[model samples]
Target: MAGSFHGLTVFNNNVHAQNSDSLSQADIAEPLFDIEKETYIGTILQNAANPTFRFDPRKGKSPSAFFAEVDPTPSAPGINEMVKPPTFPNVSPVAPDGLIVSSPGFHFNEQNNAMSAFQNALVPPKPNITISNSETDDGYNVFSKAGCIKCHAGSYFTNHQIIPADKIGTEPSRAKALAKTAKIFAEPLLYSPTENVPIRKNARVLKIPLNNIDEQQLRLGFAHDGKGGYKTPSLIGLYWQAPYLHDGGVAVGYEHNYGLTGTLLKGKPVDPYRSIIALVDRKERQKVIKANASLHSVHITGDGHSFWVDQESGFTKKEQIALAKYLLSLNKGRTEQQ
Candidate 1:
């Protein structure tokens, strides 16, 4: 028996021992098999400890004890399972500072109200110019006269309804337009009437003055005055639309020319009456020039002549700041849904 015990101990040494102190009886009950002897020492020990050690021949041996095992039942998920859903890309909740003209005053807390009042006072309202054309009551007519509606028409401030001029009525056209325009595929554009359009009250909140201005007075000239100039963009939610201009040139300041080339404005020097140049002081003028110079120039062939525009031409610092405020007012949950 001693010799048998020695041989069994030697053979069983090859099998890994569980920490007896840490492991429960259930963990060690399944014995590792001795291939040479064709017997399970761990199981023998378990049966020896019990008087009812009936080796039921009907019961088959367990799977290889050497193999690692995994629990078949799924474990509990981590805390991330409880998190909120992701927001739509590029679209964000309105910042407290981003109040628009059309936004409800009730949304403002006392602190927000104080900040808005300070911003309003700092940026005094510009003189509201008379608009002659009678299209729609709210400055949609001004937008049209300025040629904004050709591209920006519709409730969402974009003509998702219009196919791009280049690829009209084709899959490629829809794809290209979707890529360039934000309103395409955007939740606000698809479901909300005013999603693309910024709230007007938020514009007021941003303190952007939106009175009608004379269209002719704002045209571009030889320095790249209004030749291919797009209509002035709508102020609806202007806060969100940064890096302004159709070509995305001027972001925080205004320029007198839309093209980058000095040549565009060289011959036609912007008519002061029709340009941002007329409103700013010498210091402000320098700021506009600096901002315009920072942008890249675009060249296109026209009327047998090569012309360039700065692309940053129409935005001024004052206008940019005010426009941002006006845009903020166009947040969701402000108006009662129709």
Candidate 2:
């Protein structure tokens, strides 16, 4: 309903929202998905903390009133290394923690509350991440020049808006997963920050002010007749968290810098610069995509988001390196306020 993130984590929010949307469960459609009471498993949340990596510690975004999310066993997280693609559902999702999870007063424990605070306080490692070369600095310009900055804009590197399949142009399979959750996804209802976990019958509810959210942009966030939305993720930590794309399939090894089947699965690290090259360089990406296919990896197409930075797009190798280095350095020397 608004621009700011209240609880931020989408799938996790579904677990809590099931409480608020308790009534929706009564009429939930078949296939019995996550967020629907039937699909819920009580703990060990599948959510990752990628969204929290560079999040503003000062503000709380979530399912209550501001956060954005969905069901995608089917998908991923920067919050948890995510990308809103419709990975075919491979496993069941565990529910969010909270005694009164069925209500706004969810994740009731004091430690649970503290954990959230700590998560936002944590920052991605940025030590020596940026290259010392002059080209590294120019890379950011190249990124913006190549239109990478359009969605990957702002302090955390994400505008936090969902881009539909057509414009994004990646393989559309993963979106099939996101579209499913969009059906019953609703704005979150949160208990007042001061409310207790067990939740009183009469408790104060936090008003997640969103009168400032861009209504048009919000509409653009959704897909399939406004049911699903694919959030553009924050590009905070690209150095270590490689094997790019939503499926962790767009991988390349240190030797050849190829695909998931050729790299990470075999315990090799993904060459950041080379892998990034493949991401924006279609010729290179075709090789990587083919490599990912060797294993028939689940949802690992590593295709789409047709933004390129290679010579084919009229850029030089020098500029491509600069862009990759800048992306890797996104973690340091800046606060979320930037």
Go through the candidates in order and give the C-alpha RMSD of each one to the true structure: 28.7, 12.5
Best by lDDT: 2
> All models: lDDT?
0.26, 0.54
Candidate 2, residues 1-338, lDDT tens digits: the string is 33123443334444443434332232232433545422221111223243422223235443221222333211122112211111122111211211122222443323334544666777777634547656555877798788887887777778777676666766555555434444444443444546554456666654345466565544544343443345787777777677777667677777995787778777887787678778878899999878767555456688877788888889998787788777777674335423
Quote each prediction's TM-score.
0.22, 0.65
The superposed Cα distance between candidate 1 and the true structure at residue 295, in angstroms, equals 4.0
Judge candidate 2 at residue 178 and give its lDDT. Answer: 33
Off by over 4 Å in 2: 1-5, 9-113, 127-130, 171-187, 204-210, 215-227, 294-297, 333-338
State the weakest 10-residue window (summed lDDT) of model 2.
Answer: 90-99
lDDT of 2 at 205: 51
Best by TM-score: 2
